[model samples]
Target: MEDIGYGLLDRAMIHQITERWRHGGIGIIVLQLRHVNAASLEAVQLWESQQTRLFWRYRMENDYFFFLNRMKSDRQMKLILDSAITSLKKGLQAAAAESSVDERAKPPFTIGTASASPSGLGRSAETMIYHALRDATLSMLRLRMKEDETELPFGSGQAGARSEWSSSVGIGILAKAIPTFDLHAQVSSLAKLFESNTHVQGAVIVNQGRPVGLVMKEKMHQMLAGQFGLPLYWNRSVEKIMDDDSLVVDASIPVEQVAQLAMARDISRLYDVVTITRNGKLLGAASIRSILECITNLRTEEARTANPLTGLPGNAAIQREMKQRIESRQPFAVIYADLDYFKWYNDCFGFAQGDALIRYTAAVLQDVTGILGGRGDFIGHIGGDDFIILTGSSAEDADKLCRNMIWRFDGGIKSFYNGEDVAHVVDRSGNRIEQNGVSVSLSLVYCDGSEDITTEHISQAAARLKKQAKQLNGSVHVMGEVFEKHLGEGRV
Candidate 1:
């Protein structure tokens, strides 16, 4: 109402509220014109009575309210205003939901931003949102394509004829096939394998099948120098001399993660190979050159399978894993890990810091999962701070893992705070704000063979559990038999 008291319609209040709403991208503005002159009030009444132009006026005794000129009739003005407000509220809600979904879909290493142009292409907001969403959809398609491409044969396709190379190994190859060196074995013993088998140039040292370091001829020689060489080389164990600086890849690592590691090395400083493993058990090693080649091939074969920012497998991989689990009828748990207050965190910190935070989160997930047990376990980057882990374990195990992950990330959150006071402060526009604390919400679903589970079902279950967890101030929500029972009774 424009006819409110003079003090109530102060310019400062209007400016403050208007600025706040504008910065938040909210369009509605409110103003009050108090104590209108008689002539002006008469003009307003005349304008209202005509109702021919695109303007609507309402009166409360001496006070009058004028809506935008586009709205002609009083009824039309009310309807349009109501509709616009409703639409604006819906838009805000959708934006918030989309933000949450994006955070949950992204890999731990990929950062999310409000900026339209992710690659500095100068794209508009609409174009950027479309492309980002499109890229994510394409990534899913690529994952499906990869599944179709890597068709495993029911049986071995080819058999090699017995030759000198094949036969010479046949005599004792069976014995050598079994791993003999325990953690206590001498470094020389492991090195001897390379010497005994000429085909093996250098062996990457693995601990419980997880690549901890590499033991090359050069490193071995260095360890064998001087008077200490005799005792160390002759008796010292592999555990003592094993290099501990080897980089490792988990089974569910996206090709992008591997590519980034490879790209970090110069030609001279290049690694010979990258080792792949699951839960500390070595799967195999792909030579750096071979990995680079695979990446190139994958890009051509299915450009959309990989996340551009984090390079982790997309939703396609997640769905494929779910389908495989279904087909195999195995027991497995699905974990949906989401960072809490990530949007606020990103807003508080710069984009660079946000990127660093995402990378750090990914590293934490890798480190924790690398030690897990069981086969067919996978950890995939979905796209920001959301990650998916499929494991053949009970819900309890998943809960523990999720808790550990949260504890590990707490350090980074503290670092981000950097000793800032935990006090609410007003921004330039006088809006109250507080620094975000360390927190994550986890939704875990455990499905065994007996249950008929689908990806969509799992997703719904996880979503419900996530909501429950978030309600507890961002804690782990275990969704299994207990959750099912409660949900079945409509208790949730």
Candidate 2:
């Protein structure tokens, strides 16, 4: 307890320990603190001191206290935390009952708990910690809501669709911060530090554990380059030269959001490295280079999953939207739209007109969804003339969307036809075609979201509904419920 090592592990040392534990296949039971302060430190220590038998201890950003848990089953892990939970309640009661204790000073505390054991070496220790921290945060939320639990949060290492991004630790940013204090320290020493470690772009200055300013290399070099400046300010406080307008962000923010925030700064501060913190304590800085690289990778992933022609999101995005809608239990409708008799039209008009028709459909879907659907409504292409739209589950809204899309396409269809085709209303090619003028078919599936649902269920239901609508005379919308009644369950 008296060792300087407690709460003092730098990022490198932390990573080293994590790699070791991860490679060794050890499971960690971490007591996650909502905040880290003197009161919280005392509470953690008091709790730690009471547990006579122990496992190796670890701390990160002074917010997460980790120890190895050798339990063979989740039930055993639950028992351990349940016992600690009881003791924590009793301690709070005792503290409240004691009138002699100071009334204003309440002990700092950890909230609900979560644990993880990194299995494959492919999973970095930092990522595991992040997932566990997210689990703890959710556990705390559920506890506050007074929800009774049958199993652990995050399904105890279960990986769902969104979990991959949700569980990731920050980018290569946390290990880059090095603290500096004693603003009066000689500039020669600062120069030596800059010279010694070529990688150190900046240092955060703190006094009594509070971030005061930031000293960046470019600013420092500019000051030193001035005539007589080095000699004049060599022995002075770096605070005089430090950039007071430092970029700071919470470490818990997702990379995508971080990119948006980091880019939203003023032109002058746009390229400044971001300072990442946890519970208001400095964790590290992510360089402008790192942020740009991260953004590029995100864009690349988006492009990879997008449709080649329509450029709308492909199946992955569509499925994800369905899953999210189901999870939120919002009254929403899933629309499957297909271009009826598009193949015959493509063969007649050649690929160029076929491509234009698809693009037109994409635009129509986007416009209708944006104009008629609620805030989160979206349109995604599933290749060819097939697409999907998610919108408010209102039956009226669905009807309007279907009607509007058909009208738009039909209104514009004449332009693609030759002048004589417009005069004749049906060319020789059109007469042979069963469908009229490149009609668009839309099928609607309504989900109340009360029942448990999966992406596959939504897709299958939409496909069946789409087939029913195609069998109609012209471009039309078919509701799955009505179709089910008309054809029975076998066809619906």
Candidate 3:
């Protein structure tokens, strides 16, 4: 017990004990002692030892010392806490009586209490400790506000939280902690909860701060309405009844990934609530209903702004990207790619095959950029067979990337043409084409971060450079003085 409260628990001891406690399936009860800072650490520790021996206590932070005990029902935990609170009150009362009349008017002790068992929240020490600390703060707040008659909340989180809406809205925007429970929570109590709170569809059961299970109201009721179900399982722990393998996600993850994870669940569990966490600690829960609605909104936004073919960011997104890069004052290069002889290829090979070629080109560009791109590099489709690559790489590196892309694509697109096209023969339309055999052209554009180049300015600059590529031989890139005249500076 680390000298049995005489010696303090440092960061190392706290981590060690918290982890072991979590793995051992223990519960945590936090108390917010309002007068902790008034006395020395030794004095506070001495006071705490006099309070209880049922659990080993550890000081988490200012004014908070949580105890680890065996996982028990909340009712039992409350009873234990009640006794501890009585002991603390008695000591304070005796002290006050011993002091002068002025000291009797004010008590030295007030506690904010909350408990969570290991069967609900898992082995996440950070999450459990956070909730315990938050509860203590809430308790102190309630006491100071003279809210003694107000019910002190102990589980899950606040019922309602305001939401935010933006483009590329994250899962955090819709995350909720509406209903949370412990493992020992009864079926009858849960049923009543669901009945009264019609808005909430499920509850997240946590141990400490880690999620152990999720209980959807519909599924629980469905199970209970069966033959003699209520009598058979009314008093059982939620661990046996909850969805142990529920979908959990990091809260910072984008909604795009969240939606994919949610949809990948089985058909029966597809609409289940997705629990969101922050650094492995339970933050809130999001429903599939809310996620889908947010996704629908995203799709609408993407449809209006994203490339329909490759699903890459389009002009609107690209423009925003350029604006941000320019504002950051960082040197970035933009590579504009266009398919040479694509007009004739579309005419000869038909639009269906033409789209196949475009998709193929997009894949090749993505592959190349992904390999060469720095942390800030971005790939965007500028509509049709034209695309853009933004990179923090220098002009030389951008030139190397474009050369590799063109070489790989020219070799890979051999299947796009038949013998006649490869032999520089006439097409089905009887149009004699050059021996170009459907090659690509690239125009590399650079902004040294000194110029405030807009997306329009970039598009125009690249278009001018693309003309130079069209003038060159099959599958060529232009990055020299030819395009530099447009930028008013030569690219190195």
Candidate 4:
């Protein structure tokens, strides 16, 4: 216990501890001590109780003082911790490449010491140690992955049904199948490959057809430009210098999720190439720069086609959605919602109130859809006071959806108008007008997969049904026939 306290205060001891931790020595001490006997519960209980009391006592007294009585000031301590982290990263690099040269020749890949230094400002000594231990543990994990590459056979990730998200915009759209090299490929050959192809940013490293790491052109050049340079690593395998911690993702993953994962990496690895795989086999690689660019373009295109008033997808996206569904030959419903008496309401309440009503109608549609909608259901805004819901739900669910929207819209529309204006409003000249307030007319057209249909067909059917709904009383939903049979008919 005393030796442990002393070790915390000594700079040399701290470095040694980090080194040992990286090599997997002291990391499993607690695990080794946690051998509990389920057969002897009483003995286990007594052992845990004693350990708990000792931990609290040590924390309250010795742990507190050991941090307080630092051998170095806070700034100096941070410097030491940062130095220790840099040493571990460079030392590992050096040890991996040192075989080609004498002990006097420094490792060629130790050029980016500053990049590996963790920012330790405003952090306590304890916090710095925690970070140090975390890096060591992660390094150990990467080392284990490399070790397993030889022993374990390559297989697709866990067996199960692929997630629905896997069907989204794939990361493969941005991936480029750049050069790939085996783990034991010579560093000289890798350098020549990069030299011959100036555009190649990195190469994926594989072990027996399984992607294990990535070697970046910039990082490799920085490594080989050191004093010993090519001599220190020219003959060594690329695995000695490849980054085993590079992000590896399946190709079918959504680009948005991949962007998030890429941006969340450590600063040193933030710009690393993202390795993409398909069924656990190497597919291609995408640069962080390309991933971020793709996300930006997608957002820009989405914003350009989205409705500004309700922020729902606009006519362009709506047309695309309908076209795709039609192409897939899936049974779907196009429920067109148009506001009745909206022109009179806009004339009375002004444009701002009309916009509010439009937004409110959008909210109601979204709420109803959330309750009754299934996967792949789409809600879009056609224009002011006009919305469209494209759903793959059955005709019965479409009827229920339209009914729910009418009930919610009628209930909420009352709050937007005065008490007198909700029912009947009298003009200044004493002429009374029967004002039914604003209500929604939903026109549903269901396709039964029997006849050939297009977006134009669905739009025309919904437009005709919408006119029939408008001819009726307050808040009515009318359904059109397909194949000489009525799918659903409702009125409220």
Give the candidate number with the greatest TM-score.
Answer: 4
lDDT of 3 at 430: 74
What C-alpha lDDT does candidate 4 achieve relative to the native structure?
0.62
Enumerate residue pairs that collide in model 3. 120-206, 120-207, 121-206, 121-207, 121-210, 122-210
Clashing pairs for predicted structure model 4, backbone only: none
User: Which candidate, 3 or 4, would have the higher TM-score against the true structure?
Assistant: 4
99-141 in candidate 4: lDDT tens per residue? 4334232222211111112234565333444544334433433
Models 1 onward score TM values of 0.37, 0.46, 0.42, 0.52
Clashes of each: 7, 0, 6, 0
Alpha-carbon runs more than 4 Å astray in model 2: 1-196, 203-217, 220-260, 275-285, 300-305, 316-333, 367-378, 390-403, 419-435, 444-452, 478-492
Descending-TM-score candidate ranking: 4, 2, 3, 1
lDDT, candidate 2, 1-492, per-residue tens: 322223212343355446544543233334433334455455556766664323446563433444434334334555666666666555544543443444343233335676656566687666665555446644553342222111223221111111122112354344365757555666667877887888776777765555667776655766686788788877777767776777677775656566566655543344457777777776777876466445434434544566667666677767766676777776778778888777766776889988988887887777766677765576777888888887864866776777787778787776766542622223235555444467777887777767777787777777787767756656777776422432321111
Q: Model 1 off-target regions past 4 Å?
A: 1-304, 373-375, 422-436, 481-492
Model 1 C-alpha lDDT per residue in residues 5-115, reported as the tens digit of each score: 221112333343233222321112121122234444444444334333222233332323232322222344334434543443343334434342332322211111111
* TM-score computed on alpha carbons, candidate 1: 0.37
Error of 4 at 82 (Å): 23
Q: What would the per-residue lDDT of candidate 3 be over residues 202-290, giving only the tens digit for each residue? A: 89888887888899887787678768878877887777789999998877566867877776565357557899988787889987646
